[model samples]
Target: MLVLKKVQGGESGLEATDLELVQRCLSGEQEAFAEIVARYKKLIYSVVYNIINDKQEVNDAAQEVFLRIYKSLDRYNPEYKFSTWSAKIATNLCLDILRKKKLDHVPIEEIKEVSSRLDTPEDEYINKEKSSIINQAVSELPDKYRIPIVLFHQNGLSYEEITEILKEPMSIVKNRLYRARLILREKLMPRRKEEVL
Candidate 1:
């Protein structure tokens, strides 16, 4: 096991390496597994939340993701990054949940209400409003485009990575992402013009 030291303010603190932690967990260390959960719970939850709008469903999906990961750890390829593998699991679980559920288009007013909670400067608020419009537009997109957009834009994944996660060809990933952006532009244009006028 590797114990890494962090130098903050010239004081060294110990940090456990992810691989070491994984190995320990594989060797039946419950605390190590807990550490892994602590490290990745938010990531898994965010990925699930992006696809599943319902908070309860998101929580359930996140739990399913971790359980699947735990069971399949022996099958994980060490060559790929752990986050990438975990993200694939999360994305797949979310897709499964989405497929099982009936989706409702989120109302723009609901988006406005959600965004209104944060008090920011006027310019920031305007920007956030614009962003909310864009989000609504994204939510309206067909799954083909929406999945790629969330994976590439929100999750910061590469086209190749998205291809692996979605089991689509690289060409398809690129095309979907491009089409998603174009659709968002078309959807937001009228609102943009209204704001200008």
Candidate 2:
């Protein structure tokens, strides 16, 4: 859906020579795969952590994600776009983890990072409250809406690249992204403003 053109040029760190890495991995050289892993581990961890929550669980899921990538190296097709392919694996695994855990609802309030009773209690409270609300709203989104918003705003992916990653139509990408912001705004309204702007 999202056809990436020049609009996403500023987010440079995410892109890599994935094709070359995949080729080398497929040729039975493990070190090349390690380089690829090092390059993307943080990004992949963020995606997984968004779903799994726990640091240890996120680590395991992230490892499995790379392992899956390694196994699929031979089948990797350049035309499909490497980031898209890898993210699909990560998203699917996260879904599987969620399903296996049987989490009826997300515990978003608990995920916000708050200092342990540090000074400047006023600032801490404000930051905590803001983070908790945002996290809760984002956590409540359906995976479809959730993933796109996280990848777009949090991961700094452009709509075009997001379309490539999600493999959805351009309109659907636009609509869902639009809708996601609406949901977050509504969810946060009671605690903040009546309007997003």
Candidate 3:
């Protein structure tokens, strides 16, 4: 893997630098490509895992996402932010995998198992249960709602970016996000009330 960029004396930094790395990668710097992969791996992983809950599938899907991005880098438009463009690629790959597999629900036990190593046993169990419940509810949502929820809240994409990614209008993105929150609230509220009672 390529070394992550190092800031030298008087150099602004990677955050201040825009598409220079993309340009370098395009100009045949192998390290630049590795830097791109390293930079976006976590974001890509989060995007993939939010849609596909299986750990093995998540790793496979994430690798597939990077491969696709590498192959398609030449076609990348510098007009958009690199992170946004890459995130769109990640989201689409995840959606394609989910559609092909026809996964209907996220297994709650998988969520629990993934977080088994908590500092305290009681806290770990409680957090795991809560995560499982939330994930299950999210998994139950229809694709239209679920996609927006994951893209916006989980992945931190703006409605405009999501609009471009999903190829939907801004209004549609807004409506989906709004409705997703309402649905999650309706689903969780009763459970919360029961816990109190």
My TM-score estimates for the predictions, one after another, are: 0.81, 0.75, 0.82
**Ranking of models by TM-score:** 3, 1, 2
Query: What is the TM-score of candidate 1?
Result: 0.81
lDDT (0 to 1) per candidate: 0.74, 0.74, 0.77
Model 3, 58-147: lDDT tens per residue? Answer: 888889988888788888888888888888898888778778988765432233445445448788777777777888888888888988
Per-residue lDDT over 64-182 for candidate 2, one digit per residue giving the tens place of the 0 to 100 score: 99999888888887887776677777877887888898765443323445467764877777777778778878888887787788777766677887787777898999999999899
TM-score, model 3 to reference: 0.82
lDDT rank order: 3, 1, 2
Best by TM-score: 3
lDDT of 3: 0.77
> After superposition, which runs of candidate 3 have C-alpha atoms over 4 Å from their true positions?
1-18, 106-124
Root mean square deviation (Cα) for candidate 1: 5.7
Clash count, one per candidate:
0, 2, 0
Better-scoring candidate (TM-score), 1 or 3: 3
TM-score of 2: 0.75
